[model samples]
Target: MNSDTRTAPLACAPRTPALMVQGTCSNAGKSILAAAFCRIFLQDGLRVAPFKAQNMALNSCVTPDGLEMGRAQAVQAAACRLDPDVRMNPVLLKPCSDVGSQVIVMGRPVGVMRVRQYVDYKPQARDAAFATYDSLAAEHDVMVIEGAGSPAEINLKAHDIVNMAMARHAGARVLLVGDIDRGGVFAALVGTMELLEGWERDHVAGYLLNKFRGDASLLDPALDFMQQRTGRPVLGVVPYLRDLGLPEEDSVTFKEGLPGLRDGVAAEGGSEEPGTGPGSLPDILLDIVLVDLPHISNFTDVDALRGEPDVRLRVARTPADLPAPDGRMPDAVILPGSKNTTGDLRTLRASGMADALARLASDPDGPVVAGICAGLQMLGLCVADPLGLEGGGSEQGLGLLPVRTELAAEKTLRRTTGVHPRSGLPVAGYEIRHGITVAAEGGEGGGTGPGRGGAAFPFLLREDGGPLGWGTHGGRVWGTSLHGVFDADGFRRHFLDGLRTRRGLAPLGRVVASYSLDPALDRLADAVRAAVDMDAIYDMLHLRPGRV
Candidate 1:
């Protein structure tokens, strides 16, 4: 269609043929491998790329093009040094309710389509999937594709874009990854391979064993026996990187315990580090509770906190599930972003959390309650349902802050800049949401306007304007559409530092922004290499720098 598409032949693909790094199950380290491999290829000075045919998760993100896609694709894009775009992830299915989803095609929210309705939409989804692969393949020398949860899930095999079907369609080689940490790594690997039908089985170029604990020498014999029996290569046996920062796909990987890794207690609690800044913040444990609402998206917001030795965080699913801080009350409670705004609101209310939250917001001495995205919406005075416009019902909010949220008939998403007119934080992260919580009601003049950044004006009303869900008082309660808001330097520490100061604790000097993610990537690659066949991995996949 254009000059770039015309010479698409030069578009880079693995010279020896690209190999996929799919996992036996979810969180089997497939995403890490994708990012790590991209980083490794980038380190080798070659222009590498990443792709994922279909990623189904509430954890979504905005691409540089101002379109919505899954956050994992964003991470992989960062690893490969590419600007995030919806093309790399053309078909994004973000669920709005239990049985419904909002289908995003080519970076735009097309319509609120039903799941059952998508069954016959294959012809459309396949065309977009191939178009995306072709575009990415044309730009780089090597493309690394990440598959969805366990290619072995028998019932989910059809309408499949992440596994064998994708491999065959793209004419790409595949590598299966199984988590040894889950204990039946051998069975999982062999079982998955056994389920593949004919040609689908042939695309698998190799296999990788991931997340082994201590001592690889002990597993050598098992490795030998399996290699011979399965006729697949084991690339590398990787040890787990305890502090890796690759964001997780869902809450299934969540862990709860005393703050940080330590002695005598939690085997996974966390550990003592040098005063992670001023008056020893990372070393001074603070108890935290994360409100586990249904429809939660972008859990990565809390990843850094999870890695912190001083801050103890846990997910609490109900009003009675409140986790106390050490021997005292929780120091803070975070309401992470979610997809179904009105639904999450109703959940809070039905669970009797509505009364608990109202009391907490009114109590000056209660644990500080904070909400992000939909969590932020719940904290408002009122939150209305969007379905009502299409002729449905609505619900009231927790009313912690003066804000109110009204779900418009249309959803909104984009990448934009917001200077903290408020406090000690980093630069703008990114925003992805479907509803707007305002300070008041029915005051918005129009539903659309121009936004400063790549963002569209979805704010129900302007700052001076009043809409059904508008707000007045800010600081104590805050709402933003941005994700990764807490990741910017000084953002988390500065905020945590304030918490310490409130409790009369000294400020944690300088927060550690030098987390050194590159080393983590390299370490993961080395680990993945163990479960893979090294000789074949390099010989078959690695092309010198620019030689596609």
Candidate 2:
């Protein structure tokens, strides 16, 4: 079949030329490469949007209108200078387990399905994918499509809605990306091409070698040989970039969370194991520990903190994994978002971290304890899952925050922008959770019933008219259902400054360096543009190359 049959153009589509980035393997840098194209197009003064037919990942974001989509597309949208929309990621699969996931169609969860069951829904999913694609294509001048995993997964190619199938459906030319950092780049590129069917092979316009290290001259011979063998040119060789960070696509990002099992620190620094003594942690302006839940989601919430040179962050799966307070405890303890709150909470308690956190929170001079999403619910007095939404009926919480939560049938998804009650600094973040938490009847100590005594001070204001988070003056505990709360420089600086003060450390200057995605995106695009032939890419897309 030709491109017309594969990805039939929508009646209203703006006749925009599309290009697809497929990888030789998962984490082969397809997402960032697509983002590079998006930024490039935007810089050329072309309106652009990023597209992914389907994304299977726990990391997600809620659009301004309360629609959910994959975080990768959201990042790409930012690179394109556009607002993220559900249309960017038509079908999102948030895997709750190895065997099943909650299927989100057009930004709302319809239901959960097993791996086998989702196969039966592929035809319908493909249609939905095109519908969403057409919507964006109708508005933008260019669409940069990102493929998931590899296109050569022989077992999954028949029912595939991503990769080659997506390329065909979008009538787009494909650039196959392979990571040289993983080694065997030559074998991987050749093997992938050999595995493709005749039409699939023809759809690919060229090959892009990503994450390359060493001299470019050393790779010329192999590139020539590959081009001769597969008749596909090597478009570029992107050098191994340092400090180029982005939100990871899966839990693999937390490969560092279990440092006891792995050697060497990961690039993300989520894997450091606490040494035997207080000196195990390197001296830094501030230290923070994140409870590494079994099914942690949106841990990128801490990505911004990594930008603060004076801050040191670590992830702990158990109490013993935590660094010895060594008379100087961590400035803050963060409990991040979790896919399964009740289950992860049980894991937390089993690991003895929950009790440890309670003690820390109860200590008047202890580190500031903060929880987001599932972390927020875990701090409450009680949590209920009547329908067993997260694998429990009812469970006791850390009781650090005077609140109670119940997992409701519908999820609360919104992009919230508000001001911190105390800091009066503007803060913005998104909330994606199934629980509705309310003030419990308990007083300062935390009671079981609800009353005026149970009221807690709300710390975050919602643009839609609601309290978003709670904090206590005495306990130094903060809880919020909002994820990405740290992305805002004003709020993060204000919050971290409080911790710095509590720890007797000097506060930061008037302006703290804020974390942003723009510069990183520009760097990414520059790398790809310098390495890849824009003339060839423009030719592949049937467009004239603009001056670089």
Candidate 3:
């Protein structure tokens, strides 16, 4: 659970059986497939764990022990009913820009490096990754491995430790997954097999066609051709699933133009449409706008809010995306976390969204403006990166909150639980950031004590009575450093109810019970199990039918 250091003793258990899911390209549903296998193995009564030697993503989760790792691995761990372990993802690359990324080894940030620098550091990264994989493999009966991007990237193959190389290291049976939904599935699968070296191709067991829609049977001819061409079986054709209620692996989901919005209409499941199911929808729909920053990170923080049946969540990318002064204003505005606070702040300003946000916050009846992590920093008066931690320089914030932030060398990663001061509701989440924020010189509510009347106050009080965030305008304008705050159902409901009260609508009593991923995981497992040949999967893993 602690930061991975070389001095730590390595486990010497025998190599465990493993199955690696490699994709034809990024977002080919490799992560979801690995997660389903994890759940399936667990259901069959085997000790299972998920691993990705190296991950390049801005979406991350802080483990209970205060370590950080890719969020996809964390989701897979949940599928196995296990807490996330850093060993599951030994190397994490969080991109701050197109050319550079913050290198995280063993749950701790080492430094930021450009592509060339990272390539030179790969030897060390490879060693750490192998060591961690060994440690995790020793603890589990079987390992479900996930490969990053594609294995056929000729430019990256030499330095690759996340795809075929990792599969070879683990002696894993590789299932090349292709997204049939993207078209050219046949070409993508055949081309990948052709590009891989003979030695690398030896580990290939078969293929899994993912994200298919309509008749899966229609793919039979292509499936047969793939098998005949590559001498590999097509194990499954998984149907495309919508609104699966699972966290996405990365920002590629935004490419389709704002999640939950297709052709300017809300998708099914938790759509903005009125709910006929019991207590599903509130009397009035609360429109929530989330500012889509250029380097938006942890966008999943708003997933819980987006799932509410009565809350309509929209992504606002420019000033024009915001509600006009004369039009029906949104019920709230949220600024999500960012990988590069100063950089995104500049983007907001250049696009005039910063000014728009400030105007909204200043309005007496404007929708509640809330911020999380970097968003909280952007709400302050200034964001300074004196050490060049975030490409250096400082930027003027939106000035909605009376605070200032300074980027430090060391990053903070921890799980937190607190009480919402206004509602006295319990809240739990985690913090992952490098900026240290404090009250401005003449800022109101500078003290940690409770607020007098309804003036500016701390957003949350830690279990030990320490304050966590700042709030003003009677809780209408607030920001917190904690991500996933809305996941706390009671607190989320209370906050939403407040919005209803402000709009003169009766509060909708608790509609649904608290949310849990167990049901969702089970549903996913069921669908995948029905689609894929579990018996063949077991044979690939050398696992028995009943147990390990």
Candidate 4:
């Protein structure tokens, strides 16, 4: 290694206590662990915030002040009972292709670049990240820092701004987390430490073994060996949590299995069956198929819907995954958000999924077709990218709605509250997109009417008296730009009730409570507190028991 690239200790410690959580690999539970620490610190009466100098995720959220950041940081902010601030995650890299990504600095897009180009731009990115970190550290009593990928990536270490480099910059104690569920926990931990430089090794205060499923005592030998080998204490062995009820950070969760479907099936006594059978209750279990787009984003929008007792959610990646001609048709079809509207739309068209969706919407007795954000844009007459914002092109849409969309340079990001005029229920969500959609001129069902029964109507009337979405075919084919529209308990129940009424079944009524993360956060904190040595963690930070 070059002398200039050699790791060095911080010149002075940060006044505010900071703890950094780095992982042995991607999906080693770094984000969740950071969130748990945020909650744990908050419960102990100390002000805490989450920070990640850089994040690479397509799944994102809009802050109350209209800035965009990684969804994981937003969840962590919720754990701290604070609104998400862009400073918490300064640089966000959204991959648009295998070798290129759209770099977002301080929650705003700069430009797209290839891997080598981004590496060249690391100096400026590092400056922005350090500035943001300094500002946040000045305000919060403690900051829980999360790292991207592994610190042992030697090839990228020289330009690294997210892993051990960031830990050293913040003068934070490092907690290296390894996934026991992925096996090779011992080697992964030991190898990571062996790969780190001397100063980086000094920063590592302890080790955390995540997703441990077996007896804790069974790990005594291995834990002892790891501590002796690395000279760091084994702080925790977190249990494998099931149905954690928290939104995932990205699409990696899909690779393991469809998340909501597994829980829904287990809820029904492990039945793989889809719908209600003979002599079943009149409350029909509605099958809702979500089109898994090539660049799907904000998939957590449908998480609330999946938790409903009368809903069965499934992901459809291709035409074959959709309902068969001879098979039972789904009760509803959802086109979720996408990062690349034009690109993903082209893929869907090429894969014949577009044609299948057209057929479903055309069938009078077919399922309700709904779309969100980019999915809403795709359901329109066409999507045009005049400036080549989405790789510079235009594509024909499914023509399910009488609207046309044009990609714009400026993205709309804001928290929105509105009301569903049909059901008179309050609705709230957020908007994060770069598309401007308007009604088609001289087209049938193109007029903006009241949000009520009609061939075409507004989906919602915003609190500011503006229309947010459109619907056609008397609301059978509809879409909205809002991301979390279905999270409202009353509106979600009403929407599901509409599906039930169409199938000649009774509404299940509002038996479930509104969704909240407090219980889940508390449960997670309790688990970590029980399994981990919290006193040692506090002592590492030089913090006493009462408060900061």
- Show where candidate 1 strays beyond 4 Å: 1-16, 255-283, 307-309, 386-391, 424-426, 441-474, 514-519, 526-533, 542-547
Error of 4 at 171 (Å): 0.6
Estimate the TM-score for candidate 4: 0.92
Candidate number with the higher lDDT (2 or 3): 3
Clashes of each: 39, 7, 0, 1
Best by TM-score: 3
Name the TM-score of candidate 2. Answer: 0.89
**CA shift at 63, candidate 4, in angstroms?**
1.4
Assess each prediction's global lDDT (C-alpha) against the native: 0.65, 0.79, 0.83, 0.83
Question: Poorest 10 consecutive residues of model 2 by lDDT?
Answer: 258-267
| 1-548: candidate 2 lDDT, tens digit per residue | 22322312233322678888999998888888999999988887777899999998889999878899999999999998888899999999987776888899999998888988899988999999988788788887678999998999999999999887877777778899999998998889888887888778868888999988889989889988877777778999988766666666676646544221122123443322223243443443477778887778888888887766456666777776565345456778899988888888778788888778877766667788888988888888878999877665898888778888999989888878887777778778888999998876644535221112234778687876687888764437878888888888877787777776876666674445668899989988888889989888886676764421
Error of 4 at 527 (Å): 1.3
Clashing pairs in 4: 388-392
CA lDDT, candidate 2, residue 515: 84
C-alpha RMSD of candidate 2:
5.2
Which scores greater on TM-score, model 3 or model 4?
Answer: 3
Model 2, runs deviating above 4 Å: 1-15, 257-282, 324-328, 444-455, 463-465, 473-475, 546-548
Displacement of residue 385 (Cα, Å) in model 1 is 2.1
Model 4 bad stretches (over 4 Å): 1-11, 263-283, 324-326, 445-455
Model 3 bad stretches (over 4 Å): 1-14, 271-283, 324-327, 444-455, 511-513
